[model samples]
Target chain A: MTNEMMMLTNLNCPTCAAKLEKATQALPGMKSARVIFGAGSMNVEYDPNVLSQEKIRTLCKQMGIGVATVVPGPSSDI
Target chain B: MSRYNDWLIRNREKLVIATSGSLIVAAWLLRPLGNTFHFWAMTLAAIIAGYTVAKEAIGRLSTRQFSISLLVTIAAIGAIVIGEAWEAAAVTWLYIFGGFLEGLTLARTRSALRGLVDLMPRTAKIKRGEELVTVSAYEVKAGHVVVVLPGESIPVDGKVVAGRASVDTSSLTGEPLPAEVAVDDTVLSGTICQGGYLEVVAERVGTDTTFSQLVYLVAEAQEQKPKVQRTLDAFAQWYTPAVIMAAALVYLGSRNMHLALTFLVIGCPGALVVAAPVAVVAGLGNSAKHGILIKGGERLERIAKADVVAFDKTGTLTLGQPQVASVTGFELEEERVLSLAAAAELRSEHHLATAILSAAEKRQIEPAPADDWTIEAGLGVVAHGPDGEILVGNRRLLLSRGTDLTPEQAALMVEHEEAGETVAIIALNGQAIGLIGITDPIKPDAFGLVKALKRTGIKTTVMLTGDNPRAAQLVADQLGIDEVRAGLLPEQKVEVIRELQKTGHVVAMVGDGINDAPALAIADVSIAMGSSGTRVAMEASDIALIGDRIGQVPGAIGISRRILGVVRQNVVFAVATVLLLLAGVVLQVIHLGSGMAIHEASVLLVTLNGMRLMK
Candidate 1:
């Protein structure tokens, strides 16, 4: 499992962040997902074996949310 | 070609808008030919535009929520049901176009912080066993010496161990000027190195860096809504459903399908929903760009309306560290007097003791061997020596032992006291010798900041200090402060702030947030100075100025007022536009197309107004 931060785009309301958070959490192999609406970013902890970062971007795009520039987190201890 | 294909797929909504919008224009142009040609063109336009609207509406309905897109979709379909194809086409087209433009602008505002995250360096060069190796910035261990070259960002928070360089700390301080750095100086992550080489030992990496904390703080600030914004948001929640129910009522009563649909189109409250947050986002961004972080929209509101401003004198006004400025001895040398005071204060922990000890050491005065050092509460300490018993204290301490200050000595003590120095009188064997003058000079920014605060309409400026009256008065006089509260403990500062607040004044206090925690917490708006180094400073205060300059206090207040003003204007404008659009529908003067245009225009206008604060 690894955790990463991704900058989200076009989030006009805080509720959009909530909706996206719920969607990401429901995905398989995801330990947790949180979207900070004000910061336009999301933090996710997931098993890379079941779900890849590339798939997360595609899923968000389908939901009308754009995810850009995946920032690597210190995933060792996390 | 692949990028072009990606763009086309991503912007399919725009394609729908373009195709439908052109169909409407085609229908208008072909009107001269016949009603049949115009009817078909308009019908096709309605179908094309309404498809995207319906997709979005269905997507939202699956979530079991009422959204603006749902209202727009229903309105467009209702127009088509009434055989008003032109109205149906115009309604959907206007909604999509307005939404497109709104998305573009709001996206820009949201990127203000995303831009900061992008600047974080992803890689670092760490020295391995024999050679330097490139590693991910977060993977680098603490104490590893990392090399930063010209034009690259420093990847970790650490002190420079080698090399001379000019570093741009603008990312951290919002200052564009390159700060000069050499060995032993501290450098932070996310700041670019400009034409200089430096080796830094990694201390805090990744999210633990000060720059990352700033980003997180700003994000947290942006999420917190002000009191007025909370009220407006609650109103918007009810207003949208009310508009839907009102439209249902209007349709039942008048059976005017067009009028009811028009009401639905204009009643989304889109502008009002976005008004306050957009302004707040812009305001926070503007302040962040200046290295000043306001806690939240609520804090911004309080700062904007602050009436009385209070300050902590030591670290907030003067440089907190006192220094020995002058030493005067009537019958002995100046260095001898300093050595005598230093010996008496050798085991003392008073702030002024450090000044005396440093002064003696700088002059290479070997401290006279002394024993039995005892400190009196208000007076200085007494230490016994070989030749005669040495006494270093105030005139009262000397008077108690029957050694009063001579007239000339009294004049000298008064001069040093008036000059804002804490003087310690040194006496040997019950006779006065000389005094060491220790002064904590006022910061250069304090005087200018006071005048600026006055110009910004801060009616009363107060100075609260734990120092003596003479020292406190000296600062008050130099800064032209209106009120001086001297010899105040931390709790007394809180009382002073509360007293001002009782008289119906909004108070703002600026302090170091350590000893001044009580006053800072009690004040309406607490501003912490030089918060770049400590998390406690940011957490304890309502606002944090990362730089040491207190002059930004007035600037922060002024900018907050302007932001608050813009927020009010946006809110009022949003409500007025909605009300006006509804009135047009009631008077039979507005249709779905014109109503959607006006609503979108108002929303865009409000967003643009908020963006003005970004500059």
Candidate 2:
């Protein structure tokens, strides 16, 4: 599994953030997904064999959230 | 048609607001004519506003995720079915308007990180052989020479090889003073060259530079959820569905579908979900702006609760650099004694050795080459020099080596030690020749720092040091410290911290040396001073004060407390608003439109309240 952090724009509501997180995590080949409401960013872990990063981006766009930038890394948590 | 679709996609929220608002106005204007035109206009307004809400609700429902959008959608549909078109339109419009206001305020809270990103120079001028090539800042590599013109941001962290200029380092160190850089002086990325041209050999590029590390750390810190936020999130997971169940129960019991829908409208809990995280992000960003790197929200909470602060003396309260205060020679000149001591300590790496070598350098006295030099831990040094065997250390070292001191010499050593100066005895061939007093001066602001810590609710301030009791007492007395633990080894300092913790005090250990590492790690919160240039200091502590000033400690703690206050206020305000709105719905005083307006207003209020910590 590979982890990536994507900067999300127009992600304002916490309830919507939670819904987005659940939707992204349910995607095929996904391992985990976390939406940080305060920073307006998302951390996703997925398998390349079953899904592509572009597909994940498309999924988020479908949910009305804009992806500004995507960088590969494990996100740090408090 | 595709261009219009693109415009609609880009300005979806604004279009919804515009269409619904115009239709509502048309409905009011047409009410004077006939009921047909008025009803059609009102229906159009409700549909336009409800369209976006319904789309989000359906999208979320397909993924088995319950959202506030779903609740709002259900309320708007119930209103339209009950022939309350104005209520449906107002509810959707106000919710969208509140979201727009929330987005604006949230952006302001995150502006600190945005400002840092904006400071990065996009392009750099690099020297490629004989040609100067302009490339992206990230493209510059180590060993490449970059030219920075006056009034331009330096593109990479490097050492200057030519020219001189004063560079503004406020973005990095938070200090307004611009540092003067010349040949061999290190300059950081994101600092602006105030004047003159300089060529710098890049040492670190891209994410490896200090500027990048700082930005990355701050961003990560802002994203990390605090314990309170996590708990709230867990609560929200069950709370949303539970509210939906309660609304169903209300409909079954009261047989009032409008009241049940109103219950769903006010039950989103939007404000409570966002309360703590927003405050934490704003607080962390504000602290970073002042050059105080709080590791995370957990550390920030610990700092706010720390009541007892233990400080390591050397390199923390004192300058750590010892200088020769006075020298007394017996049966030899002071210069002769200093020369012999410097010769014996020439190859030694001890702190006292540096003081002696620097003294000899000042006097233009060359130290004789020493052979077979040996160090006694916690004592001093012994070496075989040109002038037979030479020894320099404490009086204990002299006695251990069978070197005898006269009554007068012993008296002088005692007097110096009592006066808070470290005494080093110089012995030649088992005979004491001189006594040198080394003094590590207390930091200029140490007294004020202690006073400030007490004023800021730090109950017990203790000083822990490896120096003798007299020396420690002198420094403690000057600083008004509550207690002093002197003559402590490295492990003993850790023991002191452990003891403080056992007494039920939340402790914070402040230090800057390797010996204080254990104590720093043992404390509830560890803070390192003057950590801008040292990676070890940055990694060793929970909070790293980039500058040498001791005042930043209290400043950091103050920020943490203010953040905690804001978080408490936000949570209380959010929950209270929810409870009050529920009461309003139960009494039939609030309708669907007003409930959403109040709900959105509370979320915006929580966000704006959190942004206050940025100051």
Candidate 3:
């Protein structure tokens, strides 16, 4: 519900069974993240100048969460 | 060898072979022991079965390492170690047999969906030069022309390139009647060639076939869990850890190995874990039986939580056809006006024009002869008739000819248009004399469905449509829709749904097909008018009404809410029984027999309760 990045990631958990909680610390360039817990998928919105997807996934893994995938929203589509 | 890998391969094969051979051997071996000993064997079978069942279930569950099978296996071993041979064997057999029966029931649930694969044709008849080759559907190529005989299912998605036929697409689309397809009309794989033979050009093959997609949708639906299940999983996330801790405490405090094993076996959470899924599968089965195809548990879950319902206008609410309703003229007979209009509309492809021509044919009004006929795009058709220049279309079309209608006739046309009635104006000798009114009738159950949705406390009911605002509003007004968003493009429909969902209400959008896909996807719950919808629409929707009536929309929502309620009850009942029995074990009042009996009973109880969702 928050204005976060929409994450399209495959869930290591049950499809549609994950409780998606937005990470508290924003990535340097990211505005928000939309994580679908069951699908193990996440969509993150970022300011290209600030943070990278690789950085976000590394941080999330350290936090004990797996980022199965990360894709930008349609607005980012060319 | 590591015990884990050694056990994985060896134990899996052992369990499979043992269960199969034991079933046959037990029937003959247990006869000498009489009914009491047979009961013991059955009990022992239950335990062994429980372990095997738990392993398989855990594989699917993928939630944690703790398994009921391990618990039962350990308990049986402890009983034997304690020298309670008869009791241990009885417990193991009963647990195994119980699990076998449960597995049988769950397997049957899958069979209902699997039966869909039978809908595809086994072979396809492909044309190559002069020879007709009969080959498997998998061998069929895109763009290859395939001949479908009467009563055969089309093996691939293709366009009708050579013939015309009334294909039975109901199996694919849920529409009861056959759809008439002519040259250039695209036919999907899995639709039966009902009344005629036709040559179709295949466009997509194999896995990309419509049948495969339908099967996938059904599977996906079955696997989709409601948000409630997620919450349940979150609970399990902590629950599993807590149970492990509790089991450890009981073992350490009692210093009784048998009691510790009993605790583990009894605390398996088998009934609790299986309860929601079983109910969901059953609910899906019930939906499929009635032509409603729900794609996932999440949709059912969201439908249960929906507080707002948005409807796509073209097909969901009104009969998609805009028909000729009435004809009003002071100077000309209605039939005469209709005949003139029909003659001019005969070559028109416009939906309203087709309606007029069909109406004229139905009324047995022979179209007047015309010459030099020309249809002006977005306006009326002008033709040279025996009565001079005859024009038929809208007021704009008639006015463009410098033809003026009588004040009364003009007023009538204005009134019809204001009321959202599509009227075809007829002009004889460049003078407008009459108006033929057309209206898309509100679906018979539209109002009732809307009212039922209201009773469920869904506050918003918006109708998104490509129709003129007036026409859309008329239907919306009748249906008691909370909002009317008219004249919207397909993308705009999605935008409206997104905007509405932005308000935090769990929104449900009900529509027919491609026009409704984006909107349906954006909404929390997407319902397709399955019975009369396109394959693309059904795929995009999370839920589909097998029947065309809007009434099923509410029925589906009701089913979802009830299923959720039943799931809640099952969880409560299963948990309560476990806690009660464990209390008895702690008090030392219950033995292995009573614990196993209670466990099976609770499982049956929860399973029976879960089946209520099927109703």
Candidate 4:
């Protein structure tokens, strides 16, 4: 029952120097994530049992171009 | 900005100038009569009188009476024939004074309508490649970022993408409170950024912006009253010929030129002609002062007859803001649930998102930052924290993630949805924790206005809205509306109005939008939420409620009916008295000066009756 998507951190913007900001979405297999729009970076919160962190990064990369990196949230057991 | 309206407004001034100039020339030529003589004054009076007649050509023509110019000319000729040189001069000069007074009154009205032009901002700072370029507000567009310094008007309706500020929306909403907007919060054009520098991404600019559209719509509505089919239609068609025939009959039967002349003066139609327009102008002017802009005399006349009233539900009968109606879930505290949801939605910008954030703030719940947050446009937001993953959005977002819901929770959602409530779900990790119900509450006076209209013999009160049937019906039921037409787009709303009209119902549709414009234009009398800053709705409407309150709709109708009643009373008295006095003149019982006295009395009587609308 541990909410796993909240622990992700360490991000950068793909397009500019703006820092990554925490954002929320109602997407499946992920509870929360940090997004850096300018640098195309995402730090996702999810239960690895339902969605792997790698899959979260792929989802972020496919959603928009210029995605730089995807890191695990704080709660994630990296 | 159509060429016609431009020409009309521009030419209106020119007409005044030409008429005044001609009168001055006539006055100068008559200097032989001496500076103090009435003849010189008459010349100046003729010019001012000429413009008043010319400015309202359609109004004069609508009543089918001899122009005020012709009336003054005839009076002067009569004085000349009577060898009363001073009398001719006095009458001409008095006519000019009256015309000048009318011109001044009308010029003030035009200026009032054009007041919005002064509010346009001089320049906007557009961001390009880290360098800012100054441009006029009209040149900005969507997606362009603009920097707004303190005390500057927000050049367009845009979101604060960076920085924070306190914005005063009082100019648009008339509310005294200043709103605090952070990143992603939307601000409208014309609102002053009170403090702090904020970079806004322009969502709408120029004519497409809300403030410009608001002024434009008001101007458009103010012009909808065309001069055609004036209330004097009946009198205009018959009065002139009737007067000529009556004069001929007097000359033939009495064999007296003086009797014929007396008949002409007595049957002058002055009272009859002035009665309709003065009442209309007064009614229109009074409504404008009350924030209700009636486009024309035709709207006033139509409203006087409209019996079926239709309403647009959202923002019209309801408060038009989403609020948390109820919270369901016992496992976690309500405050904690709201805080979690607000934290997740902090980065999002949506009407419903703002409602949730405001709800949490009302409970004194301070939201803690979530480790990771993502917002799905048109769905919901999700947050990841050390405890678990939380989901907050509509049903689709929950189901797409394979998130299971308890049968009881599912039923509760259905119940709220059926009643037109927007249910904001809160899920902790993968399990549903609670749900927040949001709805736009109905206005307090909505039901009262509906019942009042019904009691006044309005045949039907139909509710037409773009919202779902459940929500629309809920609002309609509360207001005791007889019928509900739900889920109608703007065009559909207009079509519904058109259909009702085809069935012989004189329908009035009340709405606020560009979408509502078509329906408003098609209705027997389109009433717009003039106070709500819906420009398209106001522009498309025949009548706009300056206060944006539904109560004004019925109040306007009441005023129109009362004004019409007075108009009818004056019409009957004026027409009957004029005919009877003409008969008396033909019989040589009424003297010339006495007839003029009575004639002036009738004109003054009608004018005083119409002035009651000013109260």
Best by TM-score: 1
Ranking by lDDT: 1, 2, 3, 4
The alpha-carbon root-mean-square deviation between model 1 and the true structure, to one decimal in Å, is 4.8
lDDT of 1 at B36: 82
* Pairs of residues at least 3 apart in sequence or in different chains that clash in candidate 2: none
Note each model's CA RMSD in angstroms.
Answer: 4.8, 5.4, 10.4, 20.7
lDDT of 3 at B337: 82
Give per-residue CA lDDT, model 3, range B210-283, as digits (tens): 66666555645665677666666666556655665776788899988777766766776667876787677777
In candidate 1, how many Å is residue B449 off? 2.6
* Span of ten consecutive residues with least summed lDDT in model 3 chain B: B5-14
Candidates' DockQ values?
0.41, 0.28, 0.03, 0.01
Cα lDDT for residue B56, candidate 4: 40
User: What lDDT tens digits, residue by residue, belong to model 1 across residues B61-163?
Assistant: 6766566777777877887788778888887787777667766655665677778778878899997766889998889788999999999999989989989
Per-residue CA lDDT of candidate 2, range B1-615, in tens?
856754565577777788888988888877888877877777788788878778767776676757676777887788778877777777777767766666676776566766776676778999988898999887799999999999999988899999999999888888899989999899998899999889999998865676766666666676666678777877776777888899999899999998998898788888887798778877787778888988878776789999999999888898888988888898899999999999988889977988888888999999887977989898888899778998888878877987678887788778888888888999999989898899988888676887788778899999999988888899999889989999999999999898889989999989884788888888999998844355566655778876666778888888888888888899999889988998899899987777877888898889888888877
Model 4 accuracy (lDDT, Cα): 0.65
TM-score of 2: 0.78
DockQ of 1: 0.41
Pairs with backbone N, CA or C atoms under 3 Å apart (clashes), candidate 1: none
What's the lDDT for residue B374 in model 2?
A: 89
